[model samples]
Target: MSRARRLTASTTAYILIPILAAVSPLLVLPAITANHGASAWASVAIGQSIGTALATVVELGWGLNGPQRVARTSEKASLRWLTLSLQTKVIALIPASAVAAVAAAFLAPSDSLTSSLVACAMTASALTATWFFLGKGTPWLILATDGLPRLVCLALSAIFLVMGAPLMTYPVLGLLLPSALAPCLALYIAAKRAPLGTKLWWRARAVISALKLQSTALFARAASAVYIALPITLVSIASPSSVAAFAAGERLMRMGLAAVAVVPNAMQAWVGAPADRQSKWSRAKRAMAANAALGFISATIFGLAAPWAVTWVFSGVVTLDPISVWLFALAIFTICTSRGTGGIGLVALTRVRAIAVSAAAGACVGIPAILLGSAWGGVPGAVAGEILAELTVLSVQVVAIRRRLAAS
Candidate 1:
């Protein structure tokens, strides 16, 4: 199979997985609220947050480092870096699993004990599998390998939801089970197809060394977790209803942005090609313009239709204030614009360090804003914080690109 075909297939699968996974969760929100109440759900969300934060740190570090190494070194060296990242996840899982077990044993269980356990297990498994694929597989294969499990689980959850199963258990179990199983399967395949040749200890040390060298990425991951994940956390703190509201807005934004992501994703490969520098620049510019235009059209349409869309799609599950919905729509537009421009520039230039730095700056600006905003303004404040942070990062990225062009 051709690489382009493989990449296209993988991207499609990756996109579908999230969309499907979201379905069950989105469906069950109303039921969870009815059964467990907001506070219980909030507690569960907190536990999930811990797992998410850990996963984000590991995943983002790998993303930043892997691409940088790929740009700078041979594909073999890039594969080695990917292998090291997988090792890091496996090593981290040992500790994470221990913690999860202790939490399950000692901590007061939520409404869905089985679901929570499954969620934790799935988290670890998914992270491990994702890293493994990153190390050994082609990009498309890696994406598909990571995404397929989630998609399957999501399908199952949807079926269960229609059958009137416990809302909390079905969604969490569906999501988590696939996550756990995919990695185990991936590992088995990996072992059979391409067994590890290097000494385990040596591999571990190499990963650690890479991790140390990529401290900037580590910091970037940490900051990104705060920047992207904080809204979910804050919404939980504000109110379950708030979470539903913010989630509705964010979901719409995400769908639109996903469409816009095609350009940047394409630009990553174009930038790395051995073409004339001016050609690369022109390609990047065109991509940026196309993405920006798409973003504007999508945002405008979404903003105009948000009320009916929210009412029709999420009526029973979430009730979003018009103002809040509008803010979210606007924020989505800004984010897409920022991401489209920044993504093309960064990928084209292979500026991994700059991307990390920009993420860190955004996080620094966002976290405090979110905290203060949630304390003072609730959901509105959280939205404002996100917008401010994104703007700050976008401004920095724009300046950086301009400077690079000047130097060139």
Candidate 2:
């Protein structure tokens, strides 16, 4: 196949995997909301948020740097690194799961089972093989190892929910099962690919060293969590109704951004490919252009459709304020831009510190903004705060790219 055709196929696969995964929840959502109203949705949202936030903790910086490293390394080296990362992540996952459980309990104490299971399921998402597949430029592996399992489980969740199964079954089937399996499958595939490196997997003390080595990416992801992953959790604390509405809007935003995510999903490896400085810089520019355009188009569509989309999707279990909808829409644009200019650019160039500092600056601005905004104006205010943080992230990244990639 031609290179352009191959990239198009890869990007399509990446886009469809997440969109299908995100949409699968809708099967249970309307039923859950129709039967119970927004409370269940609130807990589910909190669980997803906390789970996603702590997923970064469990991921231990691999999410930020893994694909780029995998792109530029040999199969044996990639397999060794994968094994070592899995070792460290397993250790991290234990505590991260505990934290997610505790956080879920605290946030949605009213719905302990739902919150805890969903949170744990989401937490388990750290083990996804998608990044490994992405780096290796094998979208088919992603579909097999990560996407299909999750889709099967989520589809089952919808059926089970209708069959009057236990509520906790949703996360168990939809999330946790695939979360546990993907890495193991990836490991088997990696071992098969690099049979000679089968014995090079890391053990106890190496896990510790990997944790220390991961601290830089850890800080960056944590900083980003303030704006990206924690908003629904925050709103759940402040207002039960608000979390549902905000989460609904945010969920749609995520689904839309999945399409946007295709750019980085495909181009990260391309941008980070073994190449001369100019060639890498040129690829990065093209990726950034594509990313920004997609973001803009997505933001506009989301801004217009969200107010009504939430009602239809959730069966009126919750509804967002127009201001909140627009804020989320604006954030979609900024986040897409940042991922291109900052996420793709910085990681490709190995500027982890720049990414960290930019995220920290965003968190510094976002935390207070979310707190105060929620206090003053409610959900819309919080959404506005998130948008500000997104802008801060985009600005810093743009500046960094100009200095780094431009010079390159």
Candidate 3:
């Protein structure tokens, strides 16, 4: 394939994977709400949100670290690094999954079984070498290994929803099963491609140390969880109906964000490649501009269409306040713009510490916003808080990028 064609295929695949993942849940939510109502839908959302946190834990820093390492490592060392990363993730998964399971049992006792299942699936999915494929700029491999199972599971979830099965089953099958299967599929494909360095598992601890050597990205991700999952956690405690509505809006916002992310994803190599500071800054600025434009466009569309979209999707069984929908959309836009300008740009510049500081600033803002917002106004307040948090983070990042580029 021509280089251009290859890039197109890779970007297309990256975009499709997240869309496919969202489609299953999006399609099922209407049914879930229609049959079981908002409360039940809320349960599933809470389960998935907790699962997301656990997945982040099992991922450690690999999602950020592995891709860069893969880009720089030689073919001979690639297998070793892959093996090492997987082992470290597995080591982390045991404890993290255990904690998630226990937390599920205690906090969501009504659906603990399904919550635990989803957690396990997330942990398994975390083991998949997605970063390797991303770094190699071969997104099609991810589509096959990750996206295909997601589709299969989506079909199954729809079938179960039609059969009037429990709401929890939808996420377990549609979300969790595919995730659990991804690592196995990745391994099968890797085995066919070349010999994997399985023997490196013994050096897992050292590998983990290497992974943590530059863990600013990990800290950033950890800190961002305040805005990412804390709201759902709080809403789950405040009101089940609100959780359902928030989840729906948040889901759509993420779909839009994922759609907007394709360009940035495709530009990672160019941005991260070894280059003079001026050249890197110029490319980064252009990429950030494109990303922010995409975000604005997505937010506008989301705000305009969200009411009709929500009503149609859930059969009017669940509806969020228009303000909440708008806030959620704004949050998505700010997140996309911040990540593009700050997250990806800093990684490319190797100014990862700035990323951590930016995330910390967001977290400091988010914790209070989420807590007070949920306490004050329920879902809308929580979302409004998130909006503030993301904007704060973005401001810090944009300033950091400017100073770093100017200093260099």
Best by lDDT: 2
C-alpha lDDT values of all predictions = 0.58, 0.81, 0.71
The residue pairs found clashing in candidate 3 are: none
lDDT, ranked from best to worst: 2, 3, 1
lDDT of 2 at 286: 86
User: Once superposed on the true structure, which residue ranges of model 2 sit more than 4 Å away at CA?
Assistant: 1-12, 405-408
Q: Regarding TM-score, does 2 or 3 come out ahead?
A: 2
Worst 10 residues of 3 by lDDT: 195-204
- Specify the poorest-scoring 10-residue window by lDDT in model 1: 130-139
Candidate 3 lDDT by residue in tens digits, 189-247: 65456555533346646775755763666677677766775567666665544666777
Q: 1 or 2: which has the higher lDDT?
A: 2
Best by TM-score: 2
Give a tens-digit lDDT track for model 2, residues 1-408.
999998788767877776766666666777667766687778888899999999987887787888877887888878878888888888888988989988898888467878898999898898876777788888778888887777788888877777777668878887899899999898888888985635655567877887888899988988898789888877666555567777888888887787557677888788888568667767878888888898889899998988787898889767887778888888898898888877677776778888998999998998888777776778888888888888898888878867875665
